[model samples]
Target chain A: DVKVTQSSRYLVKRTGEKVFLECVQDMDHENMFWYRQDPGLGLRLIYFSYDVKMKEKGDIPEGYSVSREKKERFSLILESASTNQTSMYLCASSSPPWTSGGNEQFFGPGTRLTVL
Target chain B: SQQGEEDPQALSIQEGENATMNCSYKTSINNLQWYRQNSGRGLVHLILIRSNEREKHSGRLRVTLDTSKKSSSLLITASRAADTASYFCATMTSGSARQLTFGSGTQLTVLP
Candidate 1:
């Protein structure tokens, strides 16, 4: 099975503090994504990367950024954490690009972030 | 916006009984996937049905998609206590957005 690992499962940070959520996948997947899941809203894509150093904005990209320094690793950075940012963050990795096939994302266990 | 909307946000069923849930989405899609997530855990892919296909089955789960109505239904036969969890339908849109548009989800509780 696919193993997508997240840096932390539960996190707490003061408002205005910087936050980082890391994800790594063993399967050499080309597509990686970061999403925030909330009640009623479901899972909203924050950022997605097709290749190292390549990223694209999703439906809700404001106040969030991502980095893919390596093919297996993706990072989500919160410049300044806010109370509104407190939610469940999910990381996912997929096989390859769209032209090749519809990439099916395999997700990591989400990190519950709480910004007080 | 979420492409899919699950009917009956919550469902309760007796053990050994069947549970049926519906999902409706706007716009065309290449495929629709069902996922099961236990409390506080990552989602596990249950099944995927394509637009051309009307129905698909895996083990005890059956999924059907109706393009004309832009809706889908999932049926879990002989549901067990272990089957208690949340189910979500995700629509795989056409294009570079391989991203799936997920529904709000339906929470199921199976009573033993």
Candidate 2:
């Protein structure tokens, strides 16, 4: 079984503060993703990393950045966190599609971030 | 932009009844996947149907895909109270990298 773990299940930060959400996967997958889920918006991808030091912006990448210095770890950074950034942040990992066509993703228990 | 949109945003059914949800997409896809998320939790991958395939089943779940209409449906047989969750449809567009565009989910409630 694949296991994806996040650094925190819930977090609170003040406005303009810097926040970091960490995710680690044990499956050695080459693809990792960060997404923020909101009511009526579903899960919108924020950023994704295909390989170490390789990152791509998803649909909603504003106000957020990501780091993948290591294959097992992916980090989401919130610069100057605002109240509008408060949402359930989810992390997912999957094998590259080239390796397996239409690969399924494994998601970590999300971190609910609250910005006040 | 959301490539897929789920129909009947909310559904309620009694236990032992079947629950069906539909999803329509705007573009050609390499594959479509269904995911389930409990309240305030991460998503769990339920099933995936390739574009070439019409239908697939896992356990009590059945998924059907129609490329001509660019749509898909998920059916849960003998629904139980534990089946209550938000179901999302995700699409991997043809010729795209590994990113998946997800639709606003359909919230399903099963009454005991």
Candidate 3:
């Protein structure tokens, strides 16, 4: 089965601290995405990468950034962690936007980030 | 309030009964996809229906797409307690093949 893996399942950071969440996929899919899930807000995209060394901002990318140094890995960075940023971070991957048959996304277990 | 909007933000149903969730999008889409997420976890894709398709089914899950109404629905028949989770509908907008905009999802509970 295809799998997406996140580096940390849980993290706690102090305010103004820089935090990084890493995601890796084993399927060689070219699309990677980072999202934050809140109780009522649902899943809000923070960033997404279509290919290595290329990234795009999503709906809520104000305080977030992403990096893709390799096809199998995508990283999400928080320049400065804040309490408001405390939420569950999810990483997902999909076919490079060109393939057919099950182009659906595959997700990681998720990282629960706590900003104090 | 996003492109894809799911109705009845929360639902509670008994096992063996069917559970249905509805989603509406604001723009034209190439496909509509549904996902399931357990509490405090990541999402797992359930199904995807292309714009040209009207209905599709997998196991106990049935999805229907209506391009004209810009809406779709997911029906889970003979639900089980294990089916309790949050259901999200994502819209793949026409011309945007890279990013799929997601909406607030519906929290489903199948009580045994």
lDDT of 3 by residue, B3-93 (tens): 8999889999999999999999989998999999988778889999999999999999999999999999999999999999999999988
> Which candidate, 1 or 3, has the higher DockQ?
3
> Over the stretch A9-112, how does candidate 3's per-residue lDDT look in tens digits?
99999999999999999998988999998887878888988889999888899888888999999999999989999999999998955687445889899999
- In Å, residue A82's CA in model 1 sits off its true spot by 0.4
Candidate 2 per-residue C-alpha lDDT over A47-78 given as tens digits, one digit per residue, 9 for 90 to 100: 99999999999999999999999999999999
Instruction: Find the candidate with the highest TM-score and give its number.
Output: 2
Q: Which segments of model 2 are wrong by more than 4 Å? A: none
For model 3, the stretches where C-alpha displacement exceeds 4 angstroms are none
- How high is each candidate's TM-score? 0.96, 0.98, 0.97
Q: Whose DockQ is higher: candidate 1's or candidate 2's?
A: 2
Question: How far is A92's C-alpha from truth in model 2 (Å)?
Answer: 0.2
TM-score of predicted structure 2 = 0.98
On DockQ, the candidate that comes out on top is 2
Clashes of 2: 0
Q: Candidate 3 docking: what grade? A: medium
How much native contact recovery, as a fraction, does model 3 achieve? 0.72
